[model samples]
Target: MSTTRPQLPDDRPEQGGSGVDDGAGPAAAVGRRTRRLTLVGASGVVPMARDFAREALREWGWTPAEGADRKAAAEDVLLVVSELVTNACLHAEGPEEVLVSTDGKTLRIEVSDLGSGEPAPRTPHRAGRPGGHGMFIVQRLSIDWGVLRVPGVPGKRVWAEVAAPA
Candidate 1:
């Protein structure tokens, strides 16, 4: 027997710096279900980050989901996670942390890195192009995405938000 879970509310983003006690830290699930994974000095950061996000989604009850829409939504969240982490690995001197969270209505993925480069969808987006498509993929899958310059820090946090299924 399965019980229906209430829809999540559209809550505000979580606050604070991009610090995590590696991937073994405690996760907070009070208001926002969030998991912060440290990828610095970790090998295979991208896959590890995605796996972390997947676990978070499962813990948040986003997976083992019913219906096609909900499943697709979950998949989109993971793909965006992969893209963001991959971008950090390829261009941002590797990611320092990957943060995954949700407030019942929207799922958010954030990747923090020390690279000073700003991320944006390539202008005159060429779908035929082989490289430089990470941000573009992010832009397409996510309802909204942006970069936040970590205050007093030499890095930026790239975040993307995807709407939760009703």
Candidate 2:
């Protein structure tokens, strides 16, 4: 199988940087569009998937004013990705896809699996269970999250968005 890094938009302007014209048009006013990074499957590619997300954040121009904030954000993104991917791999069947995107203020992570099963978040008191804590952690960390049911597809997409640190 081919391992390819997804393409990111080249002309998307930075929001707070100088030389960025506010009157550049509606599209430019929106600033840089979030790029999608996809991983075909969870097996054997988890580490690479995490690294890809971190690199994408850097490439999208999210730099920390001080030490390690950028790294922390990247790590947070990676952890969320790992949790979603692991849940899909463990509970679902067939190929899986992971997509990560950022819109300057928030980072969105999505994992698609071929299995039709929906992951329900268990209550905190029941969190001591051997498994089933993935969605719970996701709920606690993400600003908002949900599932998307794609017609004609055997499975669904579970997505989460975390607010970007100031």
Candidate 3:
């Protein structure tokens, strides 16, 4: 008699650029947990990144509370995501991956790209300028942010963290 092979279930999660739910819930934990998104060839990558972030936050129960600011705290997160992704697309020739994570009251975002150049805000500020405000937006919105570059590596990761709504 012949033996049959056992069936295995697929545990991989769905990837989407839209805010629509694909049945993947937010990650659960008391400490830091990371979710990575591969960005190569992703259409409408900026909004997609924002949607991905919003979904993760919803899973963590980070929605805006009653009597809070009219601009939902999630909007700030979306702005940060847009700015970081814009910078990656502009300066770094687009991002290779995007990492979203939360640690208690702080949400962290990291955009990894292939460019070797460091990122910096325009000197002396330029609010009146027609463009060049991406990093500046990042500087103002984030509670804290910086770049991480491994020695001898040809790429860099720009990260920012914002406080969650109460």
TM-scores for every candidate against the unseen true structure: 0.82, 0.69, 0.77
User: How are the candidates ranked when ordered by lDDT, highest leading?
Assistant: 1, 3, 2
- Candidate 2 local lDDT, 56-152, one digit each (tens): 6666666432457666666677788778877877887632566556657888776767777777676653855687788777777788777766466
Best by TM-score: 1
Model 1 misses residue 137 by how many Å?
1.0
List RMSD in Å for every model shown: 8.0, 9.9, 12.0
Residues 48-85, candidate 1: write the lDDT tens digits: 88888888888888898899999999999989999999
Please write out the lDDT profile of model 3 over residues 44-159, one tens digit for every residue: 88988888887777766675445555246677778888998989898888987777777667777878788876777787787998778887888887887777665675787788
**Number of the predicted model whose lDDT against the real structure is largest:** 1
List residue ranges in candidate 3 displaced over 4 A: 1-30, 69-71
Worst 10 residues of 3 by lDDT: 1-10
Better of 2 and 3 by TM-score: 3
Whichever of 1 and 3 has more lDDT, that candidate is: 1
- Model 3 lDDT, residue 18, Cα: 27
